[model samples]
Target: MSALLDEIFDVAGSVVLVTGAGSGIGRTIAETLAACGATVIGADRDEDRLGEIKDTQGVEPVHLDVADAGAVDNVVNSIVENHGRLDVVFANAGIARGGGLTTPQGTIDAFDLTAWHELLDVNVHGVVHTVRAAARPMKRQASGSIVVTASTAGLRADPLVSYSYVVAKAGVVNLVRQAALDLARWQVRVNAIAPGPFKTNIGGGGPIDPAVEARWGSTVALGRMGETRELRGLALLLASNASSFMTGCVYPVDGGALLQSLSLDPAE
Candidate 1:
């Protein structure tokens, strides 16, 4: 058993950058990090949301769009230039585009291509650009932790979801491994979070899709969607010295989703 002090996630002297910190799980992560004593700089495309985070939570807010390559670099430069040191970065920005190959008629080519590009632009390239921009300063500082949000679709494609979403999320998983190895020399750690069905705005916000609600009601062992706050402990673990030796690993937070083998592996 570890002592309370030893197990505590320490960030008292560190600064953390959380992209997409305007709402949902991202907002939860930023607020939790701040509550744990880290000076959090929350970045999001929604200036109004950023304002809310600032006014309500007192977190330092910066407007940023991770999908914009230029903004990725500029936001990172400004943060490092201002703070003089960045200790943690959560590349949690993402979007979901849903459509099956069997969509009921109408511009099939446009629909498929747009879905692919939009998901990739926001999911894969978002992480890539964010990592690239943050890495230089983190390397110079000689310490940092990066957490990217992947998905259960990343581990295995779900016919229930669009192909583009799975492909992009899977890319994030591998990107974390590659980045971890690349940054090890600089004392920076890179890892990812593969979240299962959680109550968030990923799949068209509002109430859960009736179909998904019915399925999770039975299909999931937990028997319902997860609350965003449940991820706070894991988020802080990945962002702090508590996980000093962990890297290049895709930590799945699914409620037993990955453990079930549904005759889906490529091998017979």
Candidate 2:
């Protein structure tokens, strides 16, 4: 069992790249991969956030804006050029704007188009750029793993999240499936990780009050919000050889949040 686990989960020496590595789940994933002996290049738009992890043992920080296709391409191409191969790419940069439909801003008729476009640029277009950029080298190598951070909101309606967020995540869910089919011949794998609410800096980076925490927690069968570290295991599983035969699948790392209807705030 030990040998099997080691053989399947071994990620040592792999060249992994994670976007949105400045904070939140991306930061956790990057750090964990680096600790596991993979050479991790963490890219994010925030140089300050990148600086926080620049000196970590195996994490190399790069300033990048995933929304910019050219920028994403440049960084990805540079990595493959320098390393000779790109093993894993995580398209995890995203943003959340506007509250649920309970809020006037979140309702369809009252929705802010400006906010919608802005969120889409990062959440949706960002993933497209990252995946397209990563697909090139992965296809060339004929073996690689691409993981996108989707959300449980993508799979089902959640009145707590913004409309733009839900739409973007759902887009990537299918994007993963389509890309998986397109890249399968080359043996490159594509998949999405649909995470439930975890303590992260997505909407605004800060700690949630107990009351708010409890509200989100109640929706989860686990009766609590998830810690960032909890996602590391699944992130590693999808990135490593342990899931060699898996592709085009959306793995929910939500603490059973999808097991039942979401506990939403009252519609205003």
Candidate 3:
């Protein structure tokens, strides 16, 4: 039974890359992969967060800004050159700014263009860069997995997040599908993990206000926000052979958040 389980979930010795490894879901994914015996290259623009995991047994930290296309290519090339192959990639770097339609700033008429562009540069373009760069080597190898970090917001509208955040995530959801179709011919799988409101630093890195947490939690059937650790099992499954037949799928780890309907009014 153990041997069979190992065979189904084996990821040991695989060369993996995870962007946005500094904190939140990305950090959890990177650490989980490394702990499972994959040679993980944890990349992030923040040197401090990278430093936090530098000494982790199977993780190698590197500076990376996924928004920069050239930098992304260079990093992927360097990884391939050093590791000889990239078996898995988590194109998970993203940022959130401004407010959703609930707030005055979030309304369409008052939305900040500068904030929108800045978020899109990192959230949308960054994912594109990572996927494009990773696809090259994966196609050459003819066997690799690309997991994108999408959001429940992408799957549907939500008033809790900013306009840019929703737009970027929604765009990537389709990107994952299109990329999956294009890369399937090469046996390189592409998928997206659309998470609900997990407690993470995506909203400017600090403790979440209890009232705000409760508000977000109310939208979930489980009635609570998810911890980063809760994502490990699915992350591992998608990265490993356990999900061999799964491709172009968008798996949501939302604790039934999608089952509930959200109100446009923040007070509701």
Measured by lDDT, the strongest candidate is 3
The true-versus-predicted C-alpha distance at residue 19 of model 1, in Å, is 0.8
| Ordering by lDDT | 3, 2, 1
Report the lDDT tens digits of candidate 2 across residue range 1-268. Answer: 9988878899999999999999999999999999999999999998889999988889999999988999999999999988899999999998888878667777778888888999999999999999999999888888999999999999988888888889999999999999999999999999999999888888777778877788788888898988989988889998899889999999998889999786545421
What TM-score would every model get versus the actual structure?
A: 0.89, 0.97, 0.99
What ranking emerges by TM-score with the best candidate at the front?
Answer: 3, 2, 1
Question: What are the lDDT figures for the candidates, one per model?
Answer: 0.81, 0.91, 0.94
lDDT of 1: 0.81
Put down candidate 1 lDDT per residue, 73-181, tens digits, no spaces: 9888887788888889999988778664334321245456766788899888989999998898989988899999998879985644567877898889999999999
Clashing pairs in 1: none
Worst 10 residues of 2 by lDDT: 259-268
Cα shift from native, residue 147, model 1 (Å): 0.6
Show where candidate 3 strays beyond 4 Å.
Answer: none
Candidates 1 and 2 compared: the better one by TM-score is: 2
Position 215, candidate 2: lDDT: 78
State the RMSD for candidate 1. Answer: 3.9
RMSD of 3: 0.8
